[model samples]
Target chain A: MFGRIFHLLVKEFLQMKRDKSARFRLLVPPVIQMLLFGYAATFEVFNVSTAILDLDRSQESRALTDAFVHSSRFRIAVPAASERDVRDAVERSDVQVGIVIPAGFAELLKKGRTSPVQALVDGTNSNTALIALGYVGQIAGSFGQDYARNLAERTGRALGRPMVSVGLEERYWYNPNLNSRWFFVPGVIGTLALITIVNLTAFAIVREREVGTLEQILVTPLRPVEFIIGKTLPFFLIGLLEVSIVAGFGMAWFHVPFRGNPLVLLLGTCLFLLAALAIGLLISTVCTTQQQAFSSNFFVLNPMFILSGFSFPIPSMPQALQWLTYADPLRYYLVIIRATFLKGVGLDALWPQMLALAAIALGLLTVAVLRFRKSLD
Target chain B: MAGAIVEATGLSKRFGAVMAVDGLSFAVQPGEIFGLVGPDGAGKTTTMRMLAGVMRSDDGSITVDGIDVRAHPEQAKRHVSYMPQRFGLYEDLTVEENIRFYADLFEVPRRLWEERAAAMLTASNMTPFRKRLAGQLSGGMKQKLGLTCSLVHTPRVLLLDEPTTGVDPLSRREFWQILYSLRGEGVAMVISTAYLDEAERCDRLALLHDGRMVHCDTPAGLKAKMPGAMIEVAAAEPRRVRDAVQKLPGVAGVLLIGIGAHIHVDDAGRRLPEIAAALSAAGIATTEIGEVAPSIEDLFVALLENERNAA
Candidate 1:
């Protein structure tokens, strides 16, 4: 059995090695995809172009404008003389946000009256625009509060404060800064590895069926268990190599933190890969043609990605869908990976997720091997 | 021999209600090529799959090298190399790589693989293209590469399922040369082929139809058992001649071969005269009529017709 399995592993490895194009397919593309997805796939909007319409042209209005300019979230583009300029700048895509400080003449501050300021924002890309608009509200509100406090102090008037203002202290559990890149980069690594490895193995077996080499392999002294293990070992190693490369890029280039123990990450990655390869093997067992295998893999993979909590948080999904996430190996691995990297948590805190991943890996592999063996029979 | 190298007793398999190999039984000698010759859906592949231990038989038993294949499939597989109709060559891998892969899977020792691989490549004339990927090779080269991969382990028996189906005539001949060479090495071979001419190359041929082994004998012996003499009839319109000849008194079977018709009859000495008269009566010109040796295909058709008529 050992001999048979060793033979298969060696064969798989040689196939990967002999085809330089395949090797490049297995190695380079994942890194490239990691970088592309790392930089391009982000939710946080920065450097949002904002046009300022200074209708007041007064000292107080200029000071308000200066505060908006210094905010990191907004990049002040054009100093608009009229409201039409602000609309033109926004319509032409010169600015994603517009700030309008009405002519107050500094009298509203003197009378302790709340003045309204209109902030126009482009809503074409709604998410980014909404985030930008929120920043505008925050800056204006803080500036008004500070200005009122100063006036009260200068006049020596007693300040009346409401005790019912709720200050909710919320902390991000896994990701402190809410850095989407840290989440997406690891998810991208998992996704890319899953896709490439599963596809390669699926086609690997289907190619055998199509070309008639499968019969040749079947006639050998190799046991079904041996064959399954041998076929998946090389792909398992390839997945590991890919994870390291992507993880390296994530850490060095993207400055994504890797706070978890490397060993645990490697172990989790290996289990995930085994589960992926098993799924590929199972696909191969059912499909006779390469085209069929490819289409079926896509059919399974697309759903796995959506349900895996790679794009959306599993916890935020509906109860039923969230429960389904337990079946998804990616969800567990992604959680463990994120927790380890960003939060720097270990197995002590992540044991349940780690155990779930291990269970999925073992279950998938066992079913795959059994099915393959049954097919041979 | 005391015992056949490979034996199947009442081996049966079914897909739904259609019996693919119904109570099929056969045995191959230790060092002979046993050919299973039949039409496309004659259960040839199903039988081969069962024998190779890649598929389970619904009933009966298969013994390969003294081990029950059904009970000990892996053990049986140790002594056999099965080349399915498709011949699963890894197209992405090179000729040498494919061979090496199979050799390793079969656990051929490192030293033996180097020597056997070199010889197998040379025999298939695939040495020149050893570095080329299997996908890059032509149909003929790919078949040869597939054969080489199967033979890397040097099994006692080789089960080939239509290894030369889509290959060119020249490549087909080359493939047979390799098989014949293996025969010299005392390897028992069970080959299933659609081409009757290829069946003639085997030591013995089994005529299979609807999952049953109708007849098994040497190619010449099977042809000798053909009910009557076969005559090739040439006419301006062969189809008209075929129709007319079929209605004739002694005409047994009429088959279209190329532009002419091969007419089978009970007794060629008396039947030819009757066939010619019938053709003339039907206004179909008979340019040529003479007795010719029956091919394996003619014998197969005759057997299938006999079975159908009996049913």
Candidate 2:
């Protein structure tokens, strides 16, 4: 059984090595995708173009506008001539945000009266608009607080005598720096590995079925256990290699920290890969055509990405949806990978996720083997 | 003659409402190329798969080299190599790599594997392209590679399911040559083919129709069992000739051959004058009329027609 499996692994490796296109597909695309999605595909909005309608034309309004320009979050495109320009700029996406200081903005501050500043935001891309709004609000609030303190000191009154005294001390646990890139890069590693490995293995068996080579393999003296092991092991290793490459890029280029033990990470990745390859094999057993395999893979991949807690937190999802996450090995793998690579957690902290991944891998492999045997029958 | 290399008794397989192979029974002797000749959907592949131990018979038993495949498939597999209609050859792997992979799977000793791989490659004429990936090879070359991969382990019995279905005429001939060469070495081969001409090359042929074995005998013996004389007629209009021939007093069946027609009769030579006279009366001129030998296809068609009419 071992010999047969080993032989299959060797064949898989040789096939991967000799086929230049498949080799490129197996080795190069993941690294390219990692860099493309890691650096270019980002959720953190920055360098947002803003249009300012400084109606007051006073030093205070200018200072506030200057603050918005200096901050990396917003880039001032042009001083709007009218409210119409501000609206048009935001409407056309020429600027993402528009700040309109009222006509009495400085006069109100001098006379000790409140001024309402209208900030028009483009909500077309909701996430970008939300982040830009947060930046705009922070800048305006800090400036107003400083202005109030100065005014109080000058007037012989204390601004600290307000009825509401609210303080917010924010601390980020796993990702202390709150680097969205760091969070996303690690998730990309797991996602890329899952997609590539599952697809490769799924196509491996389906291609045999398509080309009529599966019958030859089944008739061999090799047992079902041997055949499946042989089919899956090489792909498992390839998946590991891909994860390592993506992780290396994350660490080297993105400077994402690897907080977990290398051994634990490697072990976790191997288990996850086994589960993914088994799923691919199972898909292969079910699909008779390459098109069917590809379509079925998409069916598996979409749900995997959604439930794996890559884009959204799995725990925050509804209970019924969260239950579905248990079957998704990527869900456990993402936790293991993120906790290990970002938080620097050890086996003691990540053993449950690791164990869950192992169970998924074993269960999927068992089903895949049984299904493959039935397919032969 | 040295226990049957492959034996199946009362083997049956059903797909939905259709019976693919119902009560199939046959035995293949060692050192012979046994042919299963059938048309599309005749259950040849299902029977072959069961005998190869890759499929379970609905109700029956299969023993390959003394090991009951239904009961101990793994043990049965050890003695047989099945080359399915589409032989699985890893397209990404090279010819030599494919051979080595199968050899290792079968646990052939390293030294023996190298020798066998070299010999198999040479025999298949794939030695020059040993390093070329299977995907790069032509259709015929790929088929040869599939055959070589199956032969690498050197199993006692070889089960081939329509191994030359889409192969070119030259490659199909070469494939059979390799099969005959293997037979000379005392390997039993049960090969299924849609081509009756290829079936003629087998030492014995099992004619299957609608999932049941209609006849199993030497090629000559099966042809000898054809019940009527076949008369070829070249007429001015083939269709009218066929119509006139079919309506003739002594004609049993009229088959349209290329640019002519073959009329099956109880006594073709004796009735040729009458057939010619009938063709002339029907306003169709007869160019040629003579007794001709019936092909396996004709025999199969006749047998099927008989069964259909009876049903």
Interface RMSD values, listed in order for every candidate: 2.0, 1.5
lDDT of 2 by residue, B24-105 (tens): 8888888989999878899888888888877888998888878889889888887888887776777777777777877777
Model 1 agreement with the true structure over A212-280: per-residue lDDT tens digits: 666667677776677667777777887888888888888898998888898888777877887889889
Residue range with the least summed lDDT across 10 consecutive positions in model 1 chain B = B84-93
Q: What is candidate 1's CA lDDT for residue A50?
A: 86
Q: Mind giving the per-residue lDDT tens digits that candidate 1 earns over B1-311?
A: 35689989999998998999999888898789999988878899999989888899999999988899999987788788888767777777777777877777777788998898898788778788878888899888888887887878788889999888889999998998898888998899999987878888899998888898889989888888889889889877888888887877778889988768999899999987888788788888777888999987788888888888998
Q: What is the DockQ of each candidate?
A: 0.64, 0.73
lDDT (C-alpha, whole model) for all candidates: 0.83, 0.84
Name the regions of candidate 1 deviating beyond 4 angstroms.
A49-70, A75-111, A118-126, A150-180, B90-101, B108-149, B152-154, B177-186, B247-252, B266-271, B277-285
Question: Of the native A-B interface contacts, what share survives in model 2?
Answer: 0.93
Q: After superposition, how far is residue B163 of candidate 1 from its true place, in Å?
A: 2.3
lDDT for position A31 in model 2: 84
- Quote each prediction's TM-score: 0.87, 0.92
